[model samples]
Target chain A: MPVLEVDHLSKDFGKGRVVDDISFHVEAGEIVGLLGPNGAGKSTTIHMLLGFIDPTAGTIRIFGKSLRRNREDIFARLNMASPYAGFPNRLTVFENLMIYARLYGVAERAAKIRNLLGRLGIEELETKQMLELSFGEIARVRLAKAFLNDPQLLLLDEALGGLDPYAATLAKDVLTQLQREHGTAILYTSHNMVDVEEMCSRVIFLRRGRIIAMGGPTEVTRAILREDRKKPALSEAFIHASRGEPHAVE
Target chain B: MRLNRIAAVIERHVYDAKHNLERVTDTLYWPVMDIIVWGFLTLFLARHGNLRPGLISFLLGAAILWGMFRAFQRDLAVSFLAEVWSHNVIGLLATPLTLREYLSGLLAINLLKAIVGTAAAALVALLFYSYDFFPYLIALLPFIFVLMIFGLAVGILVTGLIVRYTTKIQSFTWSITGLIMPFSCVFYPVSALPGWMQPLALALPTTQAFEGLRQVVAGGGFSWERLWAGLALDGVYLLAAVASFDALFRSARVRGLLVRIE
Candidate 1:
């Protein structure tokens, strides 16, 4: 069974449908990238899947259980991170980690926080408040938070933003390692084509709240390249795809 | 069928508060300042003999109630705005926690603040005034509920506006209660309102709360009738606020309004 299933999910706030009949599935040990332009409803679609917002139409199932009915069950095994999400600025990096670890109900929370910080090469930053840490450090803390629960399914929404290349690589490698070790299903969202293409096995493209394309990297690439094999890079493909260009906008 | 989600919501909020102690303390500055300012004012009034002993009791009650109510309202607004500001609301939603749990957790935190703020205010008032702070204090617990529910109701109403429209109106929501001090008869009886506006005074929650406080202080014993009235009104207002909250969230989702703020 799929770890996460979004079936014809639609959300309408006022006049327009931001998430219009979008459907997709994420299986165990697989990483899926949700790619789109700035206002493409990618976030809205994810919000619905999480049960943060009620769907105007359709349903979401997690681990083959209705999201509405089995929210706590689904949430216990789920964790998410976004670089844009702010950790409490008043708390030290270690303190922030410890708080989340406790919320996850992890045993020996203090030890777990220490291990995660050490693993992230952020032991030196443990005493510094979040606002005092550099952007890259904050990003690492957020990434650490995402995995605090040893989540079975991890959601990353632009999780690499604000990280230096080295930090970004480390964060991505950790995610990849977790997928291998825990069979953690990952829903990765980013505008960075290189990272998405490199990390995700499957990709789903969204535009103004609708999925314009989906499949393996090669399949999606082929769809983007269409008749031309020697086309521009993936970033160009993303731009062309979202712009409704003749070759990639299908 | 699982209620664990509710506990999870509470856990997350308390966790966040614990982790963000600095920011939480910074946020409490306004209420703390409110106590200091009013604490001195009550002292000055008492010294001048202008604040009759009966009025001093009324003022002490109002000081505590205002602190709790304002804390409830401010915390709700700031917490929601903080999530909105950081784009974290999206992340939270992706969790198993529903909006209902999220809201209930916020309300719970506000209740905690109400208790602590009420205690601190009582201590400070004791230092500055000569009233039996504890005798009438049992009534303060329910008083906190009255203030918290009303504050939360207003907070939800404002949050609905924020999710759809500009949150510039949030300032208005926070300070609007300040007007309640004078008109709600926080420092005096509603009868003091010119013969023309007693009905207007009755419309405010503070009127009944003060009357209840006075009844307890005068040894009239607890007034079941007044307390029930306040609870009934709180229930009505809270329901209305929740309705607005639901409608606004739906409208925002449909219109993609969530993205507008983020």
Candidate 2:
């Protein structure tokens, strides 16, 4: 069974549809990329998957259970990280992690926190308050928080956007290692095609709340090239697709 | 509701208070100043023979009680506001923390603030006015509980509004108690209001609580009837507040406002 399944999901804001009939699934140990232009419903879809927003239609199943029916049960095994939200600024890095660890019911939380800090190479930042940390350091701490629960399925929405290159590389490496060692499934969203090509095993392209293409990196690139022969880079292909162009050769 | 999860949320606020000197001073300053000012004013009135005997006690008592009400209301509302100000609401809500656990955590923080504020006001009252509030402490229990319940109810409703509307209505969280003060009759008798407004004043838990306080301070026994009336009204208001909050939370989810609020 897939670790995450979203079937025919749609979200309408009354004035217009934000997410339209989107469907996908993520198997254990798989890394799926959700790429879209701004207002393509990327964040809205992530919010629905996290149960922060209710879908106007369709259903989400995490760990083979209906998300609406078993939200707490499913959320206990799922975690998300984003640059848009963060820990309290007044608390030290360690304090923030400890609080979330307790909330997630992680046993031997101290050791787990130490392990995550070591893995993220943020041990030196343990005593530093969130307000005292730089943007890149704060991003790393948030990533550490996402890993605190040893989540079975992870949702990362622009989690690496604000990090320095070195920190971004470390984050990708830790995520890759987590998937390899724990069979954790990840649904990642980003505009950086380099990271997507480097990490994602499969990519799903969204345009105006609908999946326009889905395949391996090379396969989607080939499809895009077959349709719009002038566009070479995957980034250009993304722009063409986002403009509602008829070049999606899926 | 999981106690551990609730405690974790409370611990977040405790850490904030411990690390931020401004937060500590903010919590302690107003209550102390209010008590000192009222304490001195009551003394001046007594010294000049311009006030009735025991007028100082009535004024100081009313000030302390009103401070307690304001503190409870502010703490509860500010706890919710803290999550929004720090942009932590989405992060915390995404966790396994249930709504009940989250509200319980806020209530715990409110309790902590109330204790501190009440103690500060009481100590200042004794030091400056030599008014012993402890003699009436037992009688004040029901009044305090009823007032806290009313405060929490208002806090919950205001939080729901702010969450639903985001920053557009955020100011309501800080000013809602003040908006209700006229109807509450906190510093006066319900009968003091115009006849047309008496019914509205009588409908508030604060009115009954103050009336009960005045009764005890005037050598009358504790008014169980008034206490029960206030408790009953608080129960109704609490139910309405919870229902409003639940509906607004659902609306926030449907509107995708929770994740977008900050």
What TM-score, over all chains together, does every model reach? 0.81, 0.95
lDDT of each: 0.73, 0.86
Q: How high is the lDDT of residue B14 in model 2?
A: 90
Worst 10 residues of 1 chain A by lDDT: A225-234
Tens-digit lDDT string for candidate 1 (B169-191): 66755676776667667667788
DockQ of each: 0.29, 0.80
* Model 1 stretches with alpha carbons more than 4 Å out: A9-21, A36-41, A52-58, A206-212, A228-244, A248-250, B1-53, B79-87, B97-116, B139-145, B155-166, B194-196, B258-262
Q: So what's the TM-score on candidate 2?
A: 0.95
Docking class of 1: acceptable
- Range of the 10 consecutive residues with the lowest summed lDDT in candidate 2 chain B: B21-30
Best by DockQ: 2
Q: What's the chain B TM-score of candidate 1?
A: 0.86
